[model samples]
Target chain A: MEADELLVLVAAGDQKAFEDLYGLVSGPVFGLVRRVVRDPAQSEEVAQEVLLELWRSAARYDPGRGTALAWVLTLAHRRAVDRVRSARAAGERELRMARRANGPAFDQVAEEVEAGLEREWVRRCLDRLTALQRQSVTLAYYDGYTYREVAERLSLPLGTVKTRMRDGLTRLRDCLGGVA
Target chain B: MTGFFRRGDLHSLAAPYALDALEPPEHKRFEKHLKRCDSCPAEVRALREDAVRLAWSTAAPAPAALRDRVLTAVRTTPQEPAPVRPEPLPRARPERSPSRGRRSPFAPFLIPLASTTAAAALVVAALFGVQASRAQDELAQERAQAREIAHVLAAPDARSTAGRDAEGQGIAVVASASRRAAVVTGSGLGTPAGERVHQLWLMRPEGKPRSLGLLAGDTPLVATGLGTNAISLAVTIEPAGGSPQPTTAPVVQLALKSVGFGE
Candidate 1:
């Protein structure tokens, strides 16, 4: 069933539909969360929270806003980023640990050559972006860094990071239009 | 369009907002703009669909156990009611004044209007007074709970340890040796089934475990009256109000000493 239809059932408190939706979206949600939170244990915790939230707030899902997958993944990403940001704010020790244990930085060429055909296509589309554009997009989206943090990391002006992200995502949208 | 957002600036935020890249304040402002703007919502929807492709690129199989956990949670957790669209408040019609251009024939009857108005005002005031007192009581209870957690966390002899369940769910215990009080904070444990709850137990070096308390919701379970001789902490699903002895296998367990308290 399409996610929208399943979500409609989910909104009506349909357990079967919710299970189907969970099966459909849990992998991407977990994977996206794992990329940001990094810790296996913490990632799972955050993923569970995100899914439970999806269940509780199913009625709040507006089909007109976006696709169910996009909605769920977006919620997952936000929660993961919130976890990382809160951990960083907890102490310098946490920030230092997170930095030391940080996942691989976004590397377009390396990623392209390493993945299967599907991911390879994504990587190639990402490669179409300029170095700065890709960096800005990757740091903010995948790394879960805010625009201010992205600016600081890349040593670019805040306005520049914002523009790069906007332009870069637009370019990516057009390039991945066929795939999406 | 105002100082909050320059002309066309909301358009640029569509991508970042879609990707969850904007900070909270900017995100809120852009969302408010989204409600009114003609073109930005479509732009955001398109951007989100594209962003989903990026998310899919990173898809790795979720842990095997997550499926059961999620399914169980869906089955057990109560679904929230669909939000009722609030009806806009009725605008007040202009009130006819007794001293207006044309006084109604009943004007004399409203001569005691001052007294009647005073009585209605007293009733409204009394209702508000009761509501305020009730709110204050709830606030006091919350404050007391916060103070208790703070006292436990701030104790000089406080020690803490954290570990994960088999499914990589986090559980942490913080206890003060002198006070014999502890708090168990767990993440990723679903709400227990009907008439059942996650129960915290303090296991002695030998013999059966003793119940600390039945955990409620996701809040940290603050348990007191602990014996210093208890060697470890464990959690299990048990009948509501708890059991003298655990009826089910422990979902997670951790040694108290591992949290760094010296004997």
Candidate 2:
């Protein structure tokens, strides 16, 4: 069933529909959270919270705004970022310092791996972006770094990072042919 | 940050805003702008769809257990009643002054002018008030979470370990014996395939391996209820959600060491 249709049922208090929605979304939600929050246990916690929020806020779902999956993923991403930011603020300075010292070289391993058609297309689109643009977008989106953080990490001006992100996403949108 | 946004600046923010890349204050400000700006909303919607595609590219199967947990929660948790959609504001129609027959031509323009002024004021007031209060609540919640983490880190007897995965991916853990909590941080672990995720495990000398949780990204993770008996920790590449048992060899393993209050 369409997520929107399922959400309509869920909004009306349909447990079965909510279950269906969960099946359709939990992976993406969890995966997205994992990408931002990194820790297995806490990722699970954040994912659970995002899903529960979905159940509670299903009534607020507006078809005019976006699809059910997008809304759910957005919520998951926000929650995951929140967890990361809060942890950073909570005296994890040593850990953050360690991470910065051992920064991951953003590689194409993720794009090279075997995947479905949609994933391949996404990778292909991402590949088309300039290295700077790709890095900026990936750092901000998948890594959950704010634009300002991305700027500091890349040692570029904040305006440059913002422009790169915006331009990169615009190109990606065009490359993906607006299918998503 | 609380000033009027130029048209170009507002339009440019649609992508970052859609991707949740903006700071909280910027995000909230853009959202308020989004409500009144027709063009930007559609742009944001499209950008969000693109992000959804990106999210789909990394789709890993969630843990089987999570399904049950979420469903159980859904069944037990009361569903919020659907919100009553607010009625659309009545259109501003010029009220005819009956006493002034054959009204001056300027009167026609005057009524709409008055109505438009009132509607604009109402919208600005309502939107600003709602957004400001919501931002404050969010800020408060964030501060609370930060305080909780601070307390955990400040606990005495906090032991920590740092190591690297086989692929040279960095992983670190800080555990507080008093709080029975630990936070794991990972880096250089690139995005896993759509079907897999890196899972962290807490291994004891004797009992079955305990799943600490799964990493979503290269961020810090908090694990609670850490057992004193856990002798070591290991991470492995497993199917998304995670596995009932380790499905692959450990990517990295580190022995837990006692500190300060010697074990």
Candidate 3:
């Protein structure tokens, strides 16, 4: 069944439909959260919360806006940002990054990143950026650095950094070529 | 330039929100704009799908134990019945329930349900319940037997299709060494078939497989799990009510994924 139909059933308390919905969307939900949370344990936690929310608020989906996948990705993105933006951001984020970046347990994630840098759509979009734009975008996003931090790290003027980040994202949106 | 907010500025600001790089104040401004902005939601979605792809660069082959843990958590947690949220259409009609049709004459008389028809109904319900309970016991026995057969045939290193079958199929597919066992079709699986339904049993050792359930649709779905090493599985062409044993040749044989074998 289509996601909208399945969601309708889920609202009606159909457990099987819920399970089926999970199978369909789990990959995207887990994949997106995994990148930002940067820790398998925390990523799993965030993914679970996102899914539970999806189940609870399934009635809120508006298909007129986008595909079911897009609606779900939006939810996943919001929740992931929340987890990373928690008050304990610095310590917890650093710890999580350290585990994934240095620990043997996260070898899989690191290796995937190294290999995936070539194939990811965002990465491809990044390629369309001017050199400084790419760096500005990366520092601000994947590394979770702010514009000021990105400027300091890149040794560029703050305005220049912000401009590059902005320009880079515009180019990315155009390159990916979606509803916008 | 509506209300002094230029299109160019809104367009530029939206990217930061999409990338999740916006600060709280900026994020709120965009959220407010998003309600009026047709393009921003789409941009965010495109950005998120891209975000997901970027996220995959950070794949962690899910831990082996993760599945078990997650499945357990999902299974055990009493999920609040998800409220059916239909796709938003402006003022869509309220959906009617299947039972919204004519009420049985018994319904009004039993408004408070004078405990009698409800009692007869309970008895009728109980009659089926008793049958279902008996079937469950039989299913348990069948599963145990299948486990035994699986044990006998399974190599010491075998990952006997025990919990996996039950877990995945939402039913117990346990087995034993006797080439006999029972299956408890999980409630997650479908309900019992109507009048005439399904019949199941062992169909290995070259003889006819034994009959397990009728229409096999009853709760726990009249399942009797079996191992290939123990016995072959085949559905029988029985009446909708099902027979005590195989009264006919096997009708449908289940090709288990190499049951009674090593993982």
Q: Which candidate number has the best DockQ?
A: 2
lDDT tens readout by residue for model 2, A1-180: 556678889888889898878877787788777767777788889999988978887877754444456667777877888888888778563223323312232232344322233454466678778878887787777777788778787889867887888788888765544312
Candidate-wise lDDT, in order: 0.62, 0.62, 0.47
Candidate with the larger TM-score of 1 and 3: 1
| Weakest 10 consecutive residues of candidate 2 chain A by summed lDDT | A100-109
Please, what are the lDDT tens digits per residue for candidate 3 over residues B172-234?
333322333333332222433455445656433212345565533423332334432232344
Error of 1 at B27 (Å): 1.6
Question: Deviation in angstroms for A78 in model 2?
Answer: 1.2
The alpha-carbon interface RMSD of model 1 comes to 20.6
DockQ for every model comes to 0.17, 0.18, 0.09
**Per-residue accuracy of model 1 over A25-119 as CA lDDT, tens digit each:** 77778877877777788989999999888888787765434446666777787788888878877753254223311233444223322113234
Candidate 2 CAPRI classification by DockQ: incorrect
Q: Candidate 1 — which residues are off by over 4 angstroms?
A: A92-116, B1-5, B85-263
For model 3 the local lDDT of residue B194 reads 53
Task: State the displacement of the C-alpha of residue A155, model 3, in Å, after optimal TM-score superposition.
Answer: 4.7
Q: What is the lDDT of residue B81 in candidate 2?
A: 73
True contacts kept of each: 0.43, 0.47, 0.18
